[model samples]
Target: MNNKLSLKNINVKYGESLALKSINLDIYKGEFVVLLGSSGAGKSTLLRTINQLNPLTSGELDFFDLGKIRNKKDLQNLRKKTGMIFQQHQLIERNTVFQNVLTGRLGFHSLLRSILPLPKFDQELALDCIDRVNLLDKALVKVKELSGGQQQRVGIARALAQNPSLILADEPIASLDPKTSHQVLSMLKDICKKDNISALTSLHQVDFAKEYGDRIIGLSHGKIVFNGKSDQLSDEILKNIYSSSTITEETNFTSNEVVMV
Candidate 1:
């Protein structure tokens, strides 16, 4: 895998409080990397900094064409190539599923065209994205009418419609039931692999990270505690990562799932 995104000594802060501390990492093309940690561990903060959603207080964040984007235009272009998925589906509840998916093309469409109405090609692309997520039947449905899982699928399709080279998913399955979570994660993994796109997903479920990620990174208190292959993640390392005293076998979420050999 070739390096597609790089961050060096990256630090993020909200006013006086620091969110990430001296972060350094490289994300390669077509790699499914997961950020794992408990709440307030800064996993989401680190992921957001990649797409410049949270400005770095210090250090370098470099993308493919924009390099180190400090200007608005450069940041806009950088965002166009990077897709983002949030915990909440973030869909327009009043809009049709097709219209919500078409929002992804706003980056590519001119302001006038997007504001007026989606063009014919844009409509086709939106439909194609909806079909890719297996939601072709829901295209005409209102976003408010869908289940949490279905709405998230819409979110994924929206991101896919952007044709991004890199995807940043912040707790994509955090809101779903166990079965729904499994389905969504499986879909995300399949999409990334099939499309040959890179993804960085922040997950609260350690077992889910182990099962779905090509590489696993564990963070605690804004610092990386573990960075290695998923198979190398022993209980000892996981304890250190979570800083927990009680580590239970029953807590293992991926033990019954298929492990990627």
Candidate 2:
């Protein structure tokens, strides 16, 4: 199968500290892949490297039909085609839901054009995205007025407005309660399946990862220790992934600040 995103011998460094080491990963069309790891295990770093948010120390990134990401223009095109969902919801609290979602379409317009009123098509698309997440009624409401789950749904709609071929969700549900997390993940998975968009999501909850992920990847100290179907993620592997970290079988932990890739 053709990959939506491919990373080969990827490495990322923050100054002298290495965050990702010779990592290799691939995401295919419509695939829902969950990333599991303890804090500082490199899940976030790996995701950021794919869209060039974290500059690679050495590696090659190939995006669907876009060839290798080797230059500034390639990076720009990659960003336009990719959608990102963050843990904090990342919405403008003062802006209406529709307004926040509309920002996703700005990538397609020139800088000057983005500042002006968006075309009718973009406006309609933003509404459609809101509807996709069952937030049509909340479109006119300020983002701050919504519940945590609703705010995350708005974030999903914003990403959907990009009409992306691939989505990268970095701990998208870390802040919500268990019930709300389930609702958000269910909505996100259903939407991606229906749209046939590939997704890579990071999570601390093992149960949720097993439930929602078609495939699961385990990260340990900046390296991938396991990558397989969810059913194949045995307990032995889980121990190896979180052994030295604070994460436990029953614990759902959260850490780190997130950014769009």
The 0-to-1 C-alpha lDDT of every candidate, in the order given, reads 0.85, 0.88
Q: Candidate 1's error at 111, in angstroms?
A: 3.0
lDDT of 1 by residue, 1-261 (tens): 335788899999999988898898888878899998767889888988887778889999777545776788888887898888889988999998999999999998778867887788888989999999899999999999999999999999999988888889998987888899999999988998999888999987777887898999989788888899989988777767766334455555355331222
Candidate 1 has a TM-score of 0.91
lDDT of 2 at 52: 84
The pairs that clash in candidate 1 are none
After superposing candidate 2, which stretches have Cα over 4 Å from the reference?
Answer: 246-261
CA lDDT, candidate 1, residue 205: 78
Best by lDDT: 2
Each prediction's Cα RMSD? 3.8, 4.3
Among all candidates shown, the one with the greatest TM-score: 2
